[model samples]
Target: MVGWLLAGSMLAGACTASSPEVERAAPSGASEATPATEASSQPAAQGSVGRILEHLEALDRIAQRNGGTRAVGSEGYDESVAYVSRHMRQLGYSVVSDRFDFDYFEQLSPTRVERLKPRKAYVDGRDVRAMVYSGAGRVSAPVEPVGFDLRSNDHTGAGCSSDDFSDLPTGSIALLRPGPCYYRDQVVNAQEAGAAAVILAFPEFTRATGVLRPTLLSGAGIEIPALAATDGTGVELARSRTRLRITARTRYSPLRGVSLIAERREARAGDVLMVGGHLDSVMDGPGINDNGSGIATILEMARAVAAKEPDAPVRFAFWGGEEIGLLGSTAYVESLSSQQTTSIEAYLNFDMVASPNFVRYVYEDEIAPAGSDEITDLFTRYFNRQDIEFKTIDLGGRSDHGAFIEQGIPVGGLFTGAEMLKSRRQRKDYGGRAGASMDGCYHRPCDDIDNINQKVLREMVGAIRHALFALLTR
Candidate 1:
C-alpha cells in the first residue's frame, strides 16, 4: 500500500507505450511551448529555484488578497492545509494534509444565463465560464446551435464527419465549440452529441471556467453533467434568429480536499524523486500560477531538498482536488499496489512551474526513462548549455504528472501554460503574442498577483531549481 507501487510509478514518462484510455474533462487553453531559463546561478547562486519563486510569489500574494487559492473546501482550503502543514513541519519533514472528504463546491451566487423566447437575456460568472462538472438545475431549452458544443467532438452531427448522435433529438439543447476534448468530452459529446441537453459556446471572445456546479445527480459512477454558455451568450444567441429559450441556474457545493503524503527517509533511497503541487484553488481564484506555482515549487523544494542532503526519499506531495479532475493525483495513483508498481525510479513534476509566460519547454516523452531521459537531458542540457529559450511539447493530458503518466511513471516536468494556444512556435521562442495565451489569467478572477510574468516567473523558478539540483543531486 505505501510501498513504491510501480506501474512505472503510476505511468510517468515514455508515457507507458501510448496510454489514453479515458480522461478528458479539464482542458481549456493552457499556453506554453517552452523557452526561457536561468533564473538562478547568479546574484549569489540564489539556490533552490530562487528560494522557490519567493514562496511561489508568497502563494501568489495569498491568492491575490485572499479568494483565488486554498479553494477545495474553503476556509481557503483549510488555510492552505495549515500553510503546507506548517511548511513541511518546519523542514524537518513528515507532514500530511491527507484527510479525504470530497464533494465540495463554492460559488454561492452568480451564474444565471437566461435568454428566453424571441427576446430577453442575461449571463454571468464574470461574463461566461462554468465547467467544473457542470450539471445542476434550471434550463428552459429550445436552443441547439450545435456548431462545436462538443460532448467530445461532434462537429455537428451527420456533417462534422460523424460520431453519430442517432440524429439529435429529445428536448434538444446541445450546442458546442471548445476542442481537443474533456469536460466529460463536452458531456459525453452531448449525450453522444444527439443532444437533448447541453450548451457550451466560446469560439472566440474567450476566457471562462465554471461547470461542475452540481448537487449530486449521480456519484461513484460519476456523471457530473453539462449546462454551460458564453461567447457572449453565443453573441446574443447569434443575434437571435429566434428559437432561443435557454434558462440557466447553476449553484454549487461539493467540497472536501485533503492530500498530503510526506516522506523523507534518505539513506540512499535512490530513484524516487516525486514532487507535488495543487493546494486546491479555483474559486474567486487563489491559484497563483494555476497552482500557486505548484504549491510554491513543491513546498520550497521540500524545504531545499530536505536541507540539501538526500539521495532519494524525496516525496513531498500536497494535492487535493487539483482543480477537480486530477483528483489528488488520480486518487494517489489509483491507490497503488501492483507489485508496489515496481519500486519506482523516476517522477519529477512541478505543476505550473512558476508562471508569467513560462517557456523553456520539455516533455517530448522520448521513450522517457533512463531516469526520465536523464531528466529531459538535464533540461535539454541546461537550455542548450545556457543559450536559453525553450519549447518541446507533446506529452498531452495536463498535470499531476498525468497521474504518474496513467500508471507507468517515467515522467518529466516544467509547465507555465493553461488555457493554452500561443503558437507560431511560441511566438518565435517565448516572445509573446503570436496567438497569445500563456495563461491569460488561466482560471480567471484575473489569475491574480497582477497576472505575473516576473521574467516568466524567474525562468520558472530557475528551471525548477535546476531540475531539482540535477535530479536530487545525481
Candidate 2:
C-alpha cells in the first residue's frame, strides 16, 4: 500500500520556507552561545563525538537486529529508545521522557494486485496500494481514463467538469495526473466534480506515490474515496477499454507519539538551541538512512555537549509520529505556554545528513542566520577546503524544524537531499548523472548501514560538530 516507508521523503522537495522578517543581528545586549573555542580539544562538555558515533552504530546494529521499522510504538522503535536512554543515563545529564499517547494503525493486508484481463493487460497492484490515504472506496465503473486537469468546483464522472459533475450520474470515477497542484487536491477536485471516486497518478517507474496532507479536506468534507495510482496504471487501463473494477481502502488517522526533553540551565541567555529528528516511520521498511542518519547525528551532538556541559545548555529531542503528521513535534510545541514560547535563540535541525554522493544543502539563508551563519559559511569553506560542491535551499518545515519555524525562531540545517528528481543543472553539478538522485531507497527497508555513504557520514559528523561547537562553545 502507499506506505509511510516512502514516508515524507517528498517533504524534502515539498518544503515551503517560513517568514523571513526576524532581524538576524544579535541584539546589542542579548546573550548567545559562541562557537567552540576548542574544536581540537577533547572537551568533556561537547560529548565525545567519536564515542557518540560508536554508540549510534551500536543502536544501528541493534535496530537492524530487530524488525526494520523503528517507529516509537513498535519493537524496532523500543530498541532505539533503549539504546538512546541507556546512553543518556550514562552521560550524567538529566533525562526526562515526556510520555504521550497516540492512535496508531498498522497495515494488515498485503497490497492486493489483480488483473481482470488475463493476457491483455497485467496490473501493477502497487498503484492501488498507494494513494491509499486519499485512497479509499470502491469503483465498479469501467475505468475511463481522461488526461487533463480535474477542474475545481464540481465533478461527476469521466470527462466531467465542475458544472458537469453536479449533474453527473452516480458511480463514476475520474483519473488525474500529478501536476497543477497537490495530488490530494487533484483527487479532491475530481470528487468535487461529482466523481464518485478519484485516481491521482504518480511517476510510473518507482511505482511510488507522494502524499499531501493539508489542513483541509474536499468532498464536502465527505471525501469520496481517492487513490494515487501509477501513471502506468492509467496507461494499461487505456490499452483496451476493459472494465477496470478497483477498490482501495486507504486510511490516515491521528496518532499520538512520545518525545524526550532535557534541560541544562546555562545563564538565562534568553535563547534555546534545539536539534532533533522524527522517531517514526511507515510500516514497510526500516527508516535507517531516511532518518537513522539524522537521529544519530543529533543524539551524538547532544551527548557530546551534555558530557562537558557547554556555556549554554542545548535541548535535544527525538520526536515521534513525524511520519504520520509531524505529530510529536507539533504536539510538543503546541502544548508550550504562549509565554514560554519566545525563548529560542535559533533552531538548527538535521535530517538525512548522510547521502551517497554527499551533495550538501544549507536549508536557510542567502547568508545563514547569525546563530548558524558562521556554520553555513564554514560548510562552504570546508567544501572549498576539500574541493567539494554544495548548494543552499530555502528554509522548509518538511521535518521537525517546521515546529520551531512556526514559533518564529531563526532555523537552518544540513541535509543531503531526498528522492529529488535531479535536474540538468544538478547533473552538471555532480556525478552519478545529471538526473541522478541522492538515494532511491529513501524510506525503504534497504536504507540500512550499508546504504549509508561513509564519506557522507564523515561530512555529517564534521558539519554537526562545527555547528554545535560554534553554537555552544563560542
Candidate 3:
C-alpha cells in the first residue's frame, strides 16, 4: 500500500465510515438479479487458505534473506518478481516482466538544524529531520515564521498558500505547520517565494514525541532543502526570531523496477477483466499484510482459475513502485494505445485485505467510473449472501486502481483496512478492539507474517474468488 501521508493529495485523507443504509442499496436504476447458488460460485480447490499462506511464507523468507525489505530498487523486490513470474509460467500463463525507470531517493547523512544566534544545536531524528525527497543544501540565515496562528485552536493551514510566504525574504528559512493541505504544496510554495529552505512543524495537538517525517512526493524543480520539526522546536523558533543553519544531503538516482503481467495462453478476445495489487513493500518492513495478503490471494486465484476458460481475457498485474507512487500501473496505462486501453473493460484491485482488526470493505461506487457500481455490487452481493456485514471506502488515487480510473476505466476492490482506528460500532460488527488501528503493524517493522489475521484472510479470499468467477462469466 502507498504511504497514507507521503502520497500527498493523491490519497484520500483517511478512510471514513460509510452510511450503512446508503451502501446496502443497489446501484441507481439497475434491476436486481438473483444471487448465484453455491454450486455456481464454488472456487477452485487450490484456492485454499493453506496455499495462500505458503505463498506468504515464501515471500517472508525472500525478505528475510534480502535485508528485511521488498521495496522497489531492492534485491528483495527483484526476487519477488522472479518468484511470481516463475509461478505464472508453471501455471501455463504467458508472463511478461515489464521494466520501467523511476527516480530513487536516498538520504546520505544525518540532517542538521542549529540555532546559530543562540549557539544551540537540536538533536537529529528527535527535534529535526529531513523530509523525503528534500534537495541537498546547507544554508545559514534568519528564520521567518509564515502564516502561523499561535493563538487560534486550529493548528492547520499555516503554509498551504502562496500568500503565506508573500513577505518572506530571499535566503531566509521559512517556518510553517502541516496540513489543511499537502506537504508538497507548502514546500513548493515556500520555494517559489524565494525561501532558502523550509521547516514544517508538527501539529501541537499530536502526542508524537519525534519530529514529523513527511514526503514532498517528487523533487523536480525543488532546489531548496526541507525539514520537519517537533512542535516545541517550531514554537521556540517562532518566538526567538533568530538565525538558523539547516543542512540536508540527499541524492536521486535513475533506477529500474519491474511489474509482472500474466495471462492464460489461450485467453478469449473482446473486453478484458483485470485484477491486480501492488507487489513492492515499503523500505521499513516485510509488509506481509500491507500487500503480501493481496498478492498471495490473487496468486492463488490465478492458480485456481488457470484451467478454466472465461468469456473474456483476464489479466493479472503485480504492480511495482506503488509505495513511492503508482509508478508501475501508471506506466502500464500510459503505454497502452487507445484501442488497447478501451479493451480493458474493468479493473479489480485488492490491497491490505487482512488487517488484524479487520472490517469487510468494498470500494465505494459513487466516486469510481460509470460501470464501477456493478463491480461493487458483485462483491457486496457475495458478502450479503454469506451473512457478513461490510462498509464502503472511498480510496481516491491511493493504490494501483487510481491509474486505471484515470483513463475512465471502471474499478472496484476489497480492503480489510489500514492505519485508521476502528470505532466502537465497528468493534460490535467486526469484534475487535475499538480505538485501535485496523492494522496495528501497518508500515512498521512488525508487519511480518504473524501480523496477519488468518480468519479475515480466509473470508476475503472467498469473496475475491466469488467475484472473480462472477466477472469472468458475465
Candidate 4:
C-alpha cells in the first residue's frame, strides 16, 4: 500500500457491526477450516492458505534477489510482473502487460536552509527537509507568511488559493501551513505569485519531533524549490521576519511502469467484476505485508476460480506505481473508453490485508459508489457467519479503488490495517497492542515475510475468497 497517512477523521466514526449467522461449507482440498457462507453453493473453486504463503515466499525471494524492494522502476517489480503474468497464462488466462510512464523524482544531495540574517544554519532532516519533486535551486530572500491562521489550531486553507498571495512580493519565500488542500496546490499558488521558494510548516499542535517531508507529487513545469519545516521553525520564521537562504538539489526523469491484466481466454464481453491490488512496494522494504499479502490473496483467488468461469466476466489486475501514488490504476482508468469504463460493474481492491496488530476493516459504504453497500454486505455477512468482528473504514482515495470510484464504479475491499495505531476498542476486538501501529513495519525495511500476521492473513484470504465467490455467482 502507499505510505500516505490514513485520514484520522475517517477512524473516529468507524462502525463495528455483525450480521445474522449464515453457514457455508468449506471448499474441497482446503487444509484449514474455511468459513461457511452464502457462496458455499459454488463449490468448484477451492482456496488454499498454503498456496497464498507460497506466493508470498516467492515474492520475498524475488525482492531479496533484487535489493530487498519490489518498488516501481526496479528489477524486483519487473520480476513480480513476470511471475504473476506467467501464472495467469499457465492458468489459461489471456494476459496483457500495459505500460505507462510517469515523472520520477530523486533527491541528489542534502537540502540546506539557513537563516541568513541571524547567521543560523538550520540542520537538514531535523529543522527542514526538501519536499519531493522540489526544484533544484539556491535562493536568498526574505520570508513572507501567506494566509497563515497562527492563532487557530485548525490548519486549513493556508496558501491553498492564489488570492492568499495577492499582496506577496516577488522572489520572496512563501511560508505556509500544511493544509486541507494538497502540497501541490500550495506550491503552485506560491509559484504563480512569483515566489522564489516554498516552505510548508507542520501544525503547531502536531506532535512531530522532526522535519515534515511533503510531496508535490509531480515536477512538471515547477521551477522554484520547496521545503517543509517543523512547527517551531515555521513559527520562528513567521514571527521574526527572517531572511533565509534555501538550496535544494534534485533530479526528475521519466520512467515506465507496467500493470498486468488477465481474464479467461474465452471470456465473453459483458459487465466485469474487477479485482486488483498494487504489486509494487516502497523502496524502504520488501513490502510483504504492505501489499505482498494483498497480491498473494488475490493470486490464490484467481487460481481457485480458474477452474470454472463465473457468470460475469472477471478481470484481475496487478497494478504498478501505487506506492508513488495511484499511478498505474489511474492511468488504466484514464486509458479506458467511456463505454469500456461503464462496462465495469464494480471493483474489489485488496491492499495491506495482514497487519501484525490487525482489524478486519471493510471499506465504508458512504464514500463508495451507490451499489457498494451490497459489496460491503457481502464481506460483512461472510465475517458474521464466521463469527468475526469487522469495522468499516473510510479510505478516501488511498488505494487502487480510488481510480475506480472516480469513474463512478462501486468499489469494496478488505484491509487488516496500516500505520494507524490500534485503539483500545480495536485491541479488544482484534487482540493486539492497542497503542502500537497496526503494521509496525509499514513502509520500512523490516516489512519482510516475518512482518505478516498469519492468522489475520488466513482470515482475510478467506474473506476475500468468500467475497469473490459471492460476487461472481450472484
Candidate 5:
C-alpha cells in the first residue's frame, strides 16, 4: 500500500468514542500494567527477529518454488495461506478461510513498443512495461504528445485537463508525463479525448535503474491500454516522426484469495478485538518486509496470547489481496452484520513494520473509532519507555485498517515506511540515510530476508507483543 502524509492535530490526552462501548476488562480478569523489559523477555518473545527471519525465509522459499512470487491466486500465496492456517490450528485456535473473488491480471505476452517511422523497437522490460490494469490490445498509430510537447520542451500538464485534447487526432496514442494528477486521471482524460491508447513517459528522476518498472492503475476499472515508458524512450518516441505500434495483451480472469482467521478457544461472546496484517505480496517479489514482517509479528503475538487464553475473545486475521487494494479486508468487513460490526472492540493493522531503513510509526487517526487513541498511546508509551524514537503518522487510507475505518470501527496500526523518502530529522532520529526511502526495496524483488532491519524487527515485535498483552490481559 502507498503511504500518505501526516494530518490533523496530534492525538490529545483523550479521544471521543464512536463505537459501542467495550467493557474495560473481561469479566474474569482485571488489567495490570507490565513493564516493557519484563513483557519482552518472556519465553514467547525470545528470538522475535529470529522467528520473523524464519517466516521471511519460508516466504522467500515459497516464492522461489512458485514462479518467484506469492501474489494472489498463485501457488505461492495458496501455500502461504496453508502455512499460516496450519500453524494457528496447531496452536489450538479455531482457524477458518474467507474466500473472495477479485479481478486478476496476467500478461499474455511481453508488451512491445516499436517506433515504426524510425524503425526501432525499444527494449521491453528496460524501456517499457504495460500498465497492470491496461486493456489487452494491439494498436498502430502516431504517438501524439499530450502533457508535454517535444518541440516546445515545456510541460503543459496536458492530460490533466480536457482542453488539452482540443486538437488531438482520433485513433492516435496519447503521450503524457507524470505531473499534478494521478495516472488514472491522465488515462481517463486520454480515453475521453478519442485517443486509442496512452503512454506515460517517466521523468528522469522516476527512471530508477533506467528501467520502466511496471505501474498499476486501481483495479476499479480502465478501458484503454496504457504503458509506462522510460524517460529516454519517451524522448525517442516524441522525436520520431512515424507512427508507433504498441502491442499489449493480458488475460483477465477470476482470482481467489483466502484470509485466515483464528479465534481463541471458548472465549467470551462480547466485543472482539481484531488484529490483522496482509499475507499476500506484490507479483514481483517475496514481499518479506512489505507484509511478511507484519504477519510474523502478529503470528507470534497470537501464539503467546493463545497460551494464556483470556476471557475476552481475540481474533487474528491474516488478510489477502491487500496489494491490489483492501479487497480481502473490505470483503470481510462487508460480510459482518451491524451487530457483528459493533461487536468488534477495535482493529489494529500492522504492515511494512520492518523496513531496512526504518522509522517507528504508529497510525494516528485524528477522528478515529472508540479505542484508537488508546492504541496509539500504548505504542507511543512503549517506545518512549524503551528510549526508542517514534512518530505518529496519519493512517491515510492505505491498508486493511481502511475497511474497518469505513465501517466506523476504530482502527490503528504500525508502518515503518514504504516508498517515502526519509527527511534529515527522521534520519537523525532513526539513524538511517536521510535521503533514502525508509524501505528502498519496497514492492521490489529484492525485499527478501536480507532487506529487513533485524533491530527494527525486534523492537517492533516487542512492541506488538506488549500491545497484545495489554489488550488480552486488560
Candidate 6:
C-alpha cells in the first residue's frame, strides 16, 4: 500500500491540522515519479485558479455568442465541444470525439389551459404543465372524470385498471389521479379508451401551489396529449360541468451530442486513472456553477498533467447531454469493450463543485468497490491537510458517475450542493445561508459566471490538484 506524504501548505491557502494516515494501493504497473514528472509537479502554477477562471470566462463568452446557454442540442454546446477539443489538441494530447443520438425537446411557446364552459384561462407553467412526452396539439373537449372518486384526494384505484376507462367517452379528455400503478400504465389505459387527451390531477397535498413538476416518462408510442393540472383547477374541471382546451407548442426531435476524450501522449499502458465532468448546461441557464466549475477544474488539471506527462494513461472526458440525463457517459461506457472497461482502474467525477453558497462534499460511495474508499480518503486527507471542513454524501447515481458504477467500476466524485436547502449546522460549517439552497440559481437563467464563488473554486481546484498529484505519484 502506498501512503500520502504530508509536509507543507499549498499555494491557495493555509494548513494547520496534524497529518492523518491513509493507505492507498499503487495502480498496476505504476512507477515512481520520473525526472520529467517531478519537473511537471513543480510547474503546478500552470493549473492555477486564475487559469481556470480564464477558461470559465471563455465558456461564458461562448454561451453569450451562441444562445446564452451550453445546453445539448444548442449551438452553444457544439461550440463548447469545439473549444475543449481545440485546447486539448494544442496541449499535445490526442483528442477523440464521440457522438450519440438523443431526443431533444424544447417548449416552443407559452402553454395554455382554459376552461371552455367557465371560459377561464389559467396560468401556464404554473397552474398547468404539459408532460414531457405529451403530443403537441390543441384539444377542446368535454372533461370526463375517470377512475375512483374524483372528489377525494385518496385515489384508491385511480387509473390502475382498464375497467376504469370502460365508461369514458371517446371524444373527451380523461381526468385521473395518480395512484398505485406506474404513470405509464395509467396513461396507456387512457389511450386505449380512445380518449382524445389525458389530464393528471394533482392531489391537494402537493405543496407547490401552482407549480407542476416535470415528468420523466418518454411516453414513446402513446400519441394523445397529456397534461398536469393543479388541485384547484382539477376540482373545478371534475365537479362543474366543464369543457377544457389545452395547448402545448412543443418540439421533440433528434439531436446528436458529442463527448470529448483526451489522453496524454506519454501514457501507453491500458491501466488508467479517468477523470471527467459533464459539459452541458441546462436549457434555462449558462450552467457556470452546475458544471462549468467542474469542466474548468478538469481542463486545468489536464494542462498540468500534460506539462508533466506520465507513463500511466490519464483519460480526461468531457461528457455531453448530462442535463437531460447521463446519456453521454452511459453511451461511452456501453461503447467500451470488456477489456477497456476492465483497464480503467478508477474514475473520479467532478460535478457542481463550485456552488455560490457552497459546502465541501465528497462522494461517500458506501457500497462501492474497494478503490472507492481510497478515492474518498484521498480527498479527505487533502482537505484535512489544508484545514478545510468537508462532508460526505451518498453516491446515489445522481450524475455521470452512475454510468461507471453500473459497470462495477469504482466511482467517486465531489458536489457542493444543488437545490436542497442547507441545514443550520452546515451554515455554521460553511458560513452561508442555512435556510436557503446551497445554489439559489441551480438550473435557472441566473447561473452565469457571477454565480461562482472564487474562494471555493480555488480551494476546490487546490484539493483536486492535490488528489491528482497523489494519484500520479502513487
Name the top lDDT candidate.
3
lDDT of each: 0.55, 0.55, 0.79, 0.78, 0.73, 0.72
What's the lDDT for candidate 4? 0.78
Best by TM-score: 3
Model 2 per-residue lDDT at 89: 60
lDDT of 3 at 364: 74
For model 5, residues 1-474, the per-residue Cα lDDT tens digits are: 533101011111111111111212122221346475445544345566676678788888888888877878888899999989888888788998998888777777888888876488866666887765677788999988765667665443457677878788999998877645556667777888898888877643244643423334354557777887777777777776459888888766767778988886788877889999999888767888878889888887777776666445899999998876577899999999999999998898999888988877788865566768888877776666656677777654567897898889888877787766677867777799987777778777888878888888888877787777687667
Provide C-alpha RMSD values for all models, in order. 19.6, 7.0, 3.9, 5.7, 7.2, 9.7
Q: Who is ahead in lDDT, 2 or 4?
A: 4
List candidate 4 stretches off by more than 4 Å.
3-47, 64-68, 114-128, 141-143, 203-214, 229-245, 308-312
> Model 1, 224-297: lDDT tens per residue?
23544545565456455245443333445445567887876443644456677667776656666777766766
Greater-TM-score candidate between 4 and 5: 5
Clashes of each: 72, 26, 0, 2, 0, 0
lDDT of 2 by residue, 1-474 (tens): 111222222332342121221212223332333334423422432344455456556656766666766755677777777666666666554567766655444333433334456533323344544433444455666554555333432221233224423544456666554443334455555666667765544443334432322211212343565554555665565554355455545555554456766555542355667777765544455666667777777776765676555546577777776665566777788877766666766677777776664456766643333444555555554444444466766543667777777776667777776666455555566555545556656666666666676565665576666666666655
CA error at residue 31 for candidate 1, angstroms: 30
> In model 4, what are the clashing residue pairs, if there are any?
24-36, 24-37
lDDT of 6 by residue, 1-474 (tens): 000000001100110111121222334323433334333433453447788888889889988887788888899998888889999898888899878888776778777888876589978655777665567778888989886375554544367678888899898989876655445567778888888888776552132434333343353665777777776667777787488888878767877779999886778766898999999987667888878999988989888788766555889999998776577898999999999999898899999878988877877754566678888877776565455678776645557887888888887777787665667767887899986767777766677889888878877777787677777668
Candidate 6: C-alpha lDDT: 0.72
Residue range with the least summed lDDT across 10 consecutive positions in model 4: 12-21
Looking at model 3, report the run of 10 residues with the lowest lDDT sum: 16-25
What range of 10 consecutive residues in model 1 has the weakest lDDT sum? Answer: 1-10
Candidate 6 stretches with Cα past 4 Å from truth are 1-47, 116-120, 125-132, 141-219, 226-243
Model 2: how far residue 347 lies from native, Å = 0.8
TM-score, cand. 2: 0.75
Winner on TM-score (1 vs 5): 5
lDDT of 4 at 318: 95
